[model samples]
Target chain A: LAKTTQPISMDSYEGQEVNITCSHNNIATNDYITWYQQFPSQGPRFIIQGYKTKVTNEVASLFIPADRKSSTLSLPRVSLSDTAVYYCLVGGLSSGSARQLTFGSGTQLTVLP
Target chain B: SAVISQKPSRDICQRGTSLTIQCQVDSQVTMMFWYRQQPGQSLTLIATANQGSEATYESGFVIDKFPISRPNLTFSTLTVSNMSPEDSSIYLCSVYGTGLNTEAFFGQGTRLTVV
Candidate 1:
């Protein structure tokens, strides 16, 4: 598992597009980039994941560069309901039964009305 | 995705008492995880629970303080011992889906407040 770095906080108005970047300079070949969102007093919810290139899901889109050293989570048309902390996790796909997650400080996305 | 049901959504406990939190999944899962999140803090994994095997504890967490049990594929328990104000936090259980790289799901979380 490699360490990840993300912005401490971000602010965006409702209906805006927000992009949060995560840097994992030491990422390994087996490592995959995953994103999770968490609200106060609740467990984190998986948003999206990508190994390379781009992967989009219902909630968010994940973009990985060719080097795979860093990735970005793009949240389109943000809303007040999307205000929460976003986490970027770097871990191997074959880590076995337990995909034990290591969380960084995370990027706090505040969606203003 | 797996659905996890955690018992005792929230509890207020005494300093010397213990509270056991139960995590039951709707379907069989190979691995179960326990995590703790303090107020306005990010989640920290406590241990990994596997059926028929002893839980694997993480750094800064010990068996006596946070004992875990996974009796079968679908159920696990985490006990917080000798509670204190510092132990007040949310405990969550998570499990990976059937395939590798599959999304992981979590319980709503158990809010524990020790006075």
Candidate 2:
């Protein structure tokens, strides 16, 4: 399993773009970086996933450098509803097989007015 | 994306008792997982619920303690046996779709409080 490190917490004002970076120095070649968001008392929800470069979704954007040692989840025009714990995970999707999906202590993002 | 439904959204169980958390997916999936999130902590994988076979548990987990059952492709259950106050936490179920470029979908989660 690739271990990830991220900020413990962050605070941002509403309508700002918040970028949370995750460092995975030992990420495997076949691994993909994924981000999930979890509000209080809820299961983590998938935000975005990317192998390299950038992948954008309706909720957020994932940017991975060429080295793939790190990735950043960018939330654009954040709102109070975006306050949650953000987790960065590195793993490979081997269909039909179970892989150890390690979740690091996520970064808690508090979007304030 | 898969829609997962978990039973007994929240429960308070007596110490030394057992509580079974059920997970049901709207579609059949091959990879189902059980996780535990202690208060103020990150999610920890408990085991892999393999269909028609014994579950593969993580290092700190065991078959007798966190027994998991995957009777079919769409449903699985996790039982926390001999519970204690320390076992109070949220248990979650997640499934990875077999199709390409798909990600894992999670159930709402079971909040268990052992007293």
Candidate 3:
């Protein structure tokens, strides 16, 4: 498993774009980057995932640099409901099976009204 | 996506007692996992519940402490035995969706508070 580092907390106001970066210096070639959001008293929800370059969905955008050592999750027009903890995980197929995801201390996003 | 239902969403238990958390998936899945999240901490993998055979636990977690059972493809249970105040946390059950780059679906989680 690749270890990830992220900020402990971030603050933003409504309508502002929030970007959270995660560093995984020892990322493996087969590893894929995934981001999950967790609200209070709830399970983590899938935000976005990407192997390289950029991937976008209606909810968020994932940008992986060419080196693939780091990735950023970009949330557009944030709202108060966007406040949650975000986790970045790096894992891939191991022996023909998906490796169990190991979560790190996530970045807590606090969206102010 | 799979739907998971966990019984007894929240509970307050006394020390030395045991609590069994049940997880049921709407459809059959090949893999089921149990995780624990301590207060103000990240989630930790407890074990991977394998059907028919014994579950494979992660480091620092033992079968005696956190026994897991997967009798079939859609149902599993995790028993927290001989609980203490330190055992208070949220337990979540998860399963992998179909495909190579599939996402995992998780249950609402069981919030256990030991007194």
Show where candidate 3 strays beyond 4 Å: A94-96
CAPRI docking class of candidate 1: medium
- How many backbone collisions does model 3 have? 0
Give the range where candidate 3 chain B is weakest over 10 consecutive residues by summed lDDT: B96-105
DockQ, each predicted model: 0.62, 0.62, 0.54
Which pairs clash (backbone N, Cα, C closer than 3 Å) in model 1? none
lDDT of 3 by residue, B22-112 (tens): 9999988877999999999999999998889999999999999999989999999999999999999999999877777737778989999
Name the runs in model 1 displaced over 4 angstroms: none
Give the top-scoring candidate (TM-score).
Answer: 3
Model 1 error, position A18 (Å): 0.1
lDDT for each residue of candidate 2 in A1-113, tens digit (9 for 90 to 100): 89999999999999999999999999988888989899998998888889999999898889999999999999999999999999999998665565667899999999999
Docking class of 3: medium
Sliding window of 10 residues with minimal summed lDDT for model 2 chain B: B96-105
**lDDT winner between candidates 1 and 3:** 3
Question: Candidates' interface RMSDs, in order?
Answer: 2.0, 1.9, 2.1
Q: Tens digit of lDDT per residue, candidate 3, span A1-113?
A: 89999999999999999999999999999888999999989988888889999999999999999999999999999999999999999988544364588999999999999
